[model samples]
Target: MAARIEIEGDRCIGAAQCVLSADKLFDQDEDGFVVVLNGEPDGEDLEDARTAAMICPSQSITVVED
Candidate 1:
């Protein structure tokens, strides 16, 4: 099963850190909030995505295995 990342919109503080950490899997909206570019990141990009979730200041990111 592939691992997936989920964002809690309410918990997000509009921090773009996730996007900065993993551009391939994350992007910021015009408001500077992060949104998942791809829920299923593969290869090295997946590692970056996981790191981004772990380092998120607001703890808004959730990683799940399916």
Candidate 2:
């Protein structure tokens, strides 16, 4: 399935769970805010995005199906 990855920077607490859970799809800026490395992840990468969304303490990560 295809999905879109979204990150809410204002809601992020810089916990880095997204980065830890899905490094290929997500990263952190210099200030440690969540960054989307690949907003449109597919295959196993889609799973990574889902994991990141699940583990985000601040609920900053979102995976919307397209």
Number of the top lDDT candidate: 2
Clashing residue pairs, backbone N/CA/C < 3 A, model 2 = none
Candidate 1 residues lying further than 4 Å off, grouped into runs, are: none
Off by over 4 Å in 2: none
Candidate 1 is scored at a TM of 0.87
Give the local distance difference test score of model 1. Answer: 0.84
TM-score of each: 0.87, 0.95
Cα lDDT tens digits, model 1, 1-66, are: 588888898888977889888888888888788788899877787789789989999998887866
Clashing pairs in 1: none
RMSD of each: 1.2, 0.7
